[model samples]
Structures are given as C-alpha cells and as structure tokens.
Target: MSSIKYLSAILILVGLSTCGAKNLQEQNTLQQTAVQLTDKTTPVVNKNTATPKEEEEEAIALPPKAPLPSKKDSTTAETFNHSRWDRILQKHVSNSGEVNYDALRNDPSELNIYIDALTHNTPTDAWTKEAILAYWINAYNALTIDLILKNYPVKSIKGIKNPWDQKLWQFGDTWQDLNTIEHKILRPMKEPRIHFAIVCASISCPKLQNKAFTASTLEIQLTQATKEFLNDPTKNELTKDAVQLSRIFKWFKKDFEITGSLIQFLNQYTDFEISESAKANYKDYNWNLNN
Candidate 1:
C-alpha cells in the first residue's frame, strides 16, 4: 500500500513540473512577439513624425515671388486725375495754340495728376478715341522729357532703359509702347499732321505745341502740323545743291509712300516744288537722344 501511494505522488509531481515548464515557454513566446510588434510600430510612428519637418524645411528654403503691377496701377494711376485733366483741357480749348508746359511741369501735384492719368484711363469708344490718343502721345512725350530732365546727363533715349522697343507701334493693347501711341494711335487714325504735333524734346523732333490737343480740334491741329512741318526749311527744303531734310521723312518713308512719292506727299501739304533728283538723295536718320 505504501509503495503504491509513493508512486502516485511521484507521478503527480512530474505532471505539475511538466505543466509549469509548458506555461513558462508559452509566456516567453508571447513576450517575444509583443516586443517585435512594439519595435515595428515605434519606427512607423517616428517615420511619420520625421517626414513633415523635412517637407516644411524644403518649403521654407524657397524665395517669395514679386507682385505684378495692375494695368491701372501701371498706366492711369501714374498719370492724372479725371477732373483736373478736364480743367487743363478747358484751358487748352481757350487757346488752341499756346500750352504752358512750364506751368504744368512746375506744379508737382499736376505732374502727378498727369502721370496718374497716363497710367490709367483706357478709352473704350470713338468719342474717347481721339482724346485718348492725343492724351497718351502728349503724356508719353512729356513723361519722356521729364525722365530726361530728371536724369539730365544721360546720352540717349536708349540710355533711359524704359520698355520701348522698335515694334512698339502696333495697334493692340499688348504692344503698349511709346512709339505705339505716336505711330499706331496718333498717326494711323489719319491724323497725318501728328508727325509734327507730338514733340520728342529734341531739335530734330517736331516742335512741342503750346496748347493741349482736344477731340474737337484734332483734325485741324493735325492738318496744320503736316503743313507746318513740310513748309519748314529745316524739315523739307527743295534745292538743287542738296536736299537737306528732317530725318523723319527717311525713317517713316513707308508712311509717306502710301500717299505717293515723298515729294508728292510733301506737296499735298506745302507749296514747295521738289524735283525727282532732289527726292532721290533722301538722307539717313539720326536717332540721337531726343531730349
């Protein structure tokens, strides 16, 4: 009986020991798996946190862009106020042949007004067309003169470094050059006398009119300009020795060609008799700084 009892006790002890060993192995396996999962999840969380900082740093390294000037800000706002410009126009109407550029330029406020008007004020209809053209041309010339005066020692218009290029005389708004105001707007509108009407602030350029240009007297003003330029000895002289003339006749030969031969074109506005031989010696243009 004693031996059987002892054998049962030994069996129970061995069984208990085996069960404890199994439980310990299972516990170790579960712990290892948990450690691996924690290791993987920790890196994923760290990686997510790391990426945004790099992206933000890269964004911070870039420079800011410049703001573009609005059309109104660039043109009209820089030229003149509407009411003051009207008053100047009224004054011009009172005397169509005498403009006071000195008075206009002297008043810094009025100069600012002119600049604002030129920078803004786009014409939308025919009624405004003539006025706008004349206004812009006058504005461009005046502004150019102002620029030259401000930077008096500069050699040429090219030295000023403004945005004027040769093709600036196209009619579209995209080609809004100083030359465009002069040739495309002022000239092609069949205001042929505009050649002498808008001054370039140089001896070679047309004389600056003392009066402002108005829509009502635009035609007559243009006619007088054409006639006066052609009649002027410095511009178009018909002589046997040599045909001394303004370079404008040579530079814008194509413009005159539409009317006829240069001499024929001149004759339309003047009483001068230009011979064929005299017309043949058309001189080269001198585009010196027209200050």
Candidate 2:
C-alpha cells in the first residue's frame, strides 16, 4: 500500500508539469498571433504617389506658339501699287511658269493697260528704294512682253535684229532699250541676283516669276529666284573638277565677282559642292522661246 501511494504522488507531479508546459506554449502562440495582426494593420506609403488626373495634367502641358511674320509690316513703300502687274501675270502665266503667249497676243488691249501704268509711273523719293527697284523690274518685264507681242510668231528674240539695242519704250523722260535698262540701271545697282529676277523670255533665262514682285516681297523673291536658277541642272552642271554654267554667268562674271569669287558666289546658293579647282565654262544657252 505504501508503494501504490508513492506512484500516485509521482503521477500527480507529472500532470502539473504538463499543464505548465501547455500554458507556456499558449503564451508563445498568442505572441506570434499578435505580431501578425500588427503587421496586417500597419499602412505602407508610396514616395511618389499622385492622383491619375494630376499625373495626366503634368504630362499634357503645351508650349506657346510663335507668331507668323506679316508681309505688310515689311512693306515700306506706301502708295506704290503693283496690283495691275499682279493681275496681268495671273491672267497670262501658268503655275508652272510658262507664258500663255497665244492668249496674251489674242488680247493685246489687256497688256496695253499694264504698259500704260508703267509709262505713267516714275520713281521718286516718296517710294522706298525697294519700290524703286521693283518698279524698274516690272517696267523691264512689261516692255519685253510688248516687244515679243509686236513681233509674235517669231521663234526667238534673236530673230529680231538688235533687239537689245533698239529703243522700244519711254521710261520717265527717256527712251530706254533692254541693254540700257539692264547694263545702265540694274547692273549699276550692284545686286547680282537681279540677273535671275529679270527674265529674257527665253528658255535659257531664269524662269519668269508667275506673280508680280512687290517691294514687300522683293527680298524673298530675289532669294527664291537665285536658288531656282542655280538648281536648274539644264542651266548649271556642277561636277568634281568643272562647272558648266549658263552663258549668263560667263557674260556677267564681273557682277558676281563684286562680293567674292565666281565659285564662292555660286557655292552660296548651290546645295552641291563646287570645288576650288572647278573651272567655269559657258553652257550652250537655249535661246528658244519660253512660251
């Protein structure tokens, strides 16, 4: 009976130990559960957080646009009107820069009005230098057109003997021929680009501008004409060792040399390189009518 009492006492001690172990384990489980709950409840923030609309607004900003330049603002000649010349050109010349010679000849009366305007007008201090230049240009072209009409059904301007020498029109107080207008006035002005602006009604000449050149647009017009003339492969052939230039360039080399050498003047307007050694020769000029 004493041995049985000892065994029971031992069993009771083991049960107490088990209960303590269970309690310790439960305390450890509660700590783990608490740590999980704290992690779930805590909030995480993004450093670059923004609303969708705000992000879109920032991405869509537009820069301010610049204003277009006005032609009228550049115009300094106050009272000179080129609307008549403009009208004549619009009626006779095609968009491709071809003259409708047949139509112009059919209605001689229309062209007479243009000549009348040129005759009555004279360059004065009231006009800007730009306007004066434009006036003479228009006068030259108008007189050329009248001369061709007077001798229409002709193959070339050269067909008429001494076309350039013959005094054809009255300019202000004097009778001026093509040679006088070109060599005496335009050449003396010291702008080589005028060679391109003044068309001779020939295939070799720089294409006649379809619109009248005005003082306001003269700067742009001259630039455009020079570029066009240089780029025409038929007129100017640029190569590695040589430049087959138009007869005009050979005739007016002096004018081109005023500012710089002939090659330098050419390189200014040409896209392709004209080497220093490239010698210039006259390309056969096609003097056929440009009608």
lDDT of 2 by residue, 1-291 (tens): 999999999999999999999999999999999999988894543438966766666557656567754545544435457788888899888765678889989987867887776777777666666787888887788788888888998788888788888887776788889888889987898888889988888889888888888888999999998998888898887876798899899898899999789898888887777888888788888888888
Each candidate's number of clashing pairs is 22, 0
C-alpha positional error of residue 55 in candidate 2 after TM-score superposition, expressed in Å: 72
- Error at 153, model 1, angstroms: 4.6
* Model 1 agreement with the true structure over 235-274: per-residue lDDT tens digits: 5665643466777777777777775676667667655566
* C-alpha RMSD (angstroms) for model 1: 14.6
Off by over 4 Å in 2: 1-79
Candidate 1 steric clashes: 22
Model 2: how far residue 94 lies from native, Å: 2.4
Top candidate by lDDT: 2
Report the alpha-carbon TM-score of model 1 versus the true structure. Answer: 0.53
